[model samples]
Every structure is written in structure tokens, then in C-alpha cells.
Target: MNDSLPGYAERLDALHQALAADFRAIIARLPWREHESILDPGCGDGFFTGLLAERLPRGVAVGLDTSTAFLEAAEARLAEQIEAGRVRLVEGNVDRLPFDDATIDGVFSAHSMQSYPDLPHALREFRRVLRAGSTLAILETDNVHSIMLSWPPDLELAVRQAEHREIGDEDSYIGTYFPRFAPRLLAEAGFTDLQREYIFIERQPPVGEALERYVELYLKYLAEQTSGRLDAAATARLAEIGDPRSKRFLPRQANFFFGSLQTLITARA
Candidate 1:
């Protein structure tokens, strides 16, 4: 339980692999054009930013992260793009972007804003940097609990409620209120033509062995995150339910759907 959480970057790399398809699909929905300059706020490993650069050939993708370590890794991961002048890695904050007003053509943040201390302030900054009519796409999930599991709806709700109290609104756990909250925040930030799409990848839900591996990986991290906050029996119960062979899995799937809302939202600046 005392282990440091600095190793989280490795966990994110695993996540990128698991959700790569969904990532690509979400990016495809954006209104893309040649030479469009994009900002990837909180671009951890720059994998997505590199992908963005690859897809946009002539376009530029500036990846911003708080960690110099992550930025170095990004620089290495995006070597080709950087060489081609399509990628730039910056160590910066979302609430206070480094670019001048109305400088960037578009802003794309994926599962990153949850880490921002002030969501409204970050949105406002994003609005400031983006040119008039430029697009801003944000993809995040607050329903990470009981997803890819077979447990009762009540059990899922219970877990979600607990996590909500523990990890109020952080990168590891942002609760389900975003479905309602993000729109209001965007509207108030002067972003118009707000379009949101609730993306639940039911067509390719990780099942069998894949589901088992993901559940194990996520549960281990969750156990550490909630260490002293969770009772022994509660922690044990999570392990039991996460097991693919557990009897509760099927019933849980029946009680609730087999997917979570990995939503993608877009707004015009």
C-alpha cells in the first residue's frame, strides 16, 4: 500500500493499448483539414498526439504535459513526427496554456481534464487559445466502476458512490456527473455549437480472457488508490467480483448493461 504512484505512466500505456480503437474512432469524428494546428492538452506519453500527427500529415500536434519525464518519453515516441515538424512537446498546464490568444486552430483533450484543478478555468483557457469557430473535442469517462464486470447494479452503484467520495474529481476517478456538467461548463465558457456523443464501445467490449486481464490490472490499482479508505471485506469483495470465473459476473451483466459511457464531447470556440 505504501508503494509510490509514480509508476502510473506504465498503467496509462496499458490503457492506450486497450482503448486504442475507441481513441481512433473518436478522433475520426473531428472535423479535420490539412495544416490544422492542434493542441493535445495533458498528452501523457504523446501516443495520441503522434497518432494525430500521423493522420494529419501537414498538420501540427503540440503535446503538453506537466511531467518533464513524460515529455521526454513523448519526444522519443514522437521522434519521427518531431523530425517532420508535425509534433511539439511542451511542459505546461491546461488552466494556463502557453500559446497566445486565438493562436491554435483546434484543441483536443482525451481523459485529461479530470486532472485539472479547475475545470471551468481550463475550459476558459482552451476557449482563449482557440481561434473563432475552431473546434474543441474532449473525451472522458466517469463510469469506470463495474465496467467490464458482471455484478449487481446495486453493487456497481455502491462502488461508484464510494469512489466518488474518495476520489472526488481527479484523473483516476471522475464520477458520472459529466454527462450533465460538461455542457453547462462549456456554454458558460463561451463555447457554442456544443455537440456531445456518448461513446460506449459495446461492439467490442473486452470479454473472456481480455476482460479478465483488464479487470485485474484496474482492480490492483484501485485497491492501492483506496488503500486505507476501504475495509478489508470490501476490498476482498472487489477482487472476487472482478474474477471472470466468479458466479456474480453473469448476474451483474444482466442487472446492468455491459458497457460504460466513454463519452466524446465537442464544442466550437
Candidate 2:
């Protein structure tokens, strides 16, 4: 996927507002002190990493991700902060983090865990890097299945069809239902003091440029799923269905799974 599209950065920035707010809420409840270190696994664009740096006093914040494109964007977005020696952006995968055991005080990841092929391996890595009693905060979207159900009947059917055509392989694109089983996974990873909280945000209807960008991305993903099987005529029909002019009849709803599940995990050496 092209991460450098013109409006992509802006759209991601808007989305990060909600993400950063949730992270702030999570941090507010935790007992943090000066000079502690935190890792943002899958820190796309480093928006939350910057937020963490601002909130922590004399602390080190690192943003890690597998995508070099995203890491570069993050570095650029956080250049001023980086030059000030507040944040670090590293290119790495979550399953194999580049950090010493017991080196970090906390791990925060959002919206990316669902794409991992081996979630348990990633969770183990998070467990291995944090000191004993360190906290981990994960925020991700629920299944596309759940999302489809929340839409209007006509729109839901359209989205479901698009998704069905898009899943080329079940093992390859195992979307975001991982959080539903997070409690069990945390226990398996030797984490204690587990808690889960669900956060729901009212959907703000996209307008003008935002709506245009949203529809374009949605159709782009849909096209990828169909893999050119959806010819021009079919594509045009889907576009008509997703038209913002009809948004009043088929409103878009955004539902995210924000888990404030905190657990004390053992660090490996």
C-alpha cells in the first residue's frame, strides 16, 4: 500500500487524535515517574510517541515499526522532537523487537497487532522487554465482521461482499479479532493484574475533503480484495454505493476496541 499518498498523512493525523487521547487516559491512571523508558510498538508516524515524550518528565520514548516507509514518515513528523533528544524512531518488527530484556518500563501499541501472523510471538516479545510489573497498553479495532453489523442494511451487505472478495487467503489476512482473546493470551504470556476496558466513540460524519479521501481509501482496499476481478462497471457501482451524497441514508459509524487492559509482565534476560 502507498503510505505516501497526498491526503494519507492528514487522515492518519486525524485518526491519531482519538488514539493519542486514549493513550493519555491510560498513562494518567498508571504510576509513572521521571526518567523511565517506554516503547511504542508499531508506532506508525510516531504521533503517540511524541505525545508520550511530552507527557513524561525526563523519560526516554522509542517508536518501533517494521515499515521503513512508516518509520521515515514518523521520523519526519517528529524531527523537531527528535532533534531535541526526546524520542527515538526505530524500524523493527514487533515479533522480534530490538531491545534488551527488562529494558523498558512500558509497551504501547495501537491498530497494528491485528496484522501480525504470530500474535503470541509478538506478545511474548512485549513480555520479554518490559521489567517485571511493567504495563502494556494495546488498542485495536474489532473484527470487520462486527463493523459490518453496525452499518445500515444496504451498506452492510455491500461491505460484506467487498470483504468476502478481498480475503484471498484466510491465514494471510486474519484481521482484528485478536483482542477478543487478549485476556487468555496475556495470561499465557505470564502477565498479572489483567484488566480490560472497552471505549466507544461517537462517529463523526466525514465531510468534504475528508469524506472524499475516506471513500477513495475504502474503494482502494475493496479493489485490492477483488484483485481486478471487479471490472470497471462493478467498481463504478460500488463507488456509487459508497457515495457521500447518500451518507444521510447510509451513515458511516466508527467503532474501535480500546482496551485499557493493564498487566504486570515478567522480563526475560
lDDT of 2 at 53: 78
Report the Cα RMSD per candidate. 4.6, 5.5
Candidate 1, residue 3: the lDDT equals 26
Give the Å shift of residue 150 in candidate 2.
8.6
Across 81-133, the per-residue lDDT of candidate 1 in tens digits comes to: 89889998888987689999999999888877657777778899999999999
Can you tell me which runs of candidate 1 are displaced by over 4 Å?
1-5, 144-148, 152-158, 166-176, 203-213, 228-231, 240-258
Candidate 1 residue-wise lDDT at 10: 64
TM-score: model 1 vs. ground truth = 0.80
lDDT of 2 at 64: 92
| The 10-residue segment with the lowest total lDDT in model 1 | 168-177
Best by TM-score: 1
Q: Give the TM-score of candidate 2.
A: 0.73
Q: Give the alpha-carbon lDDT of every model.
A: 0.73, 0.63
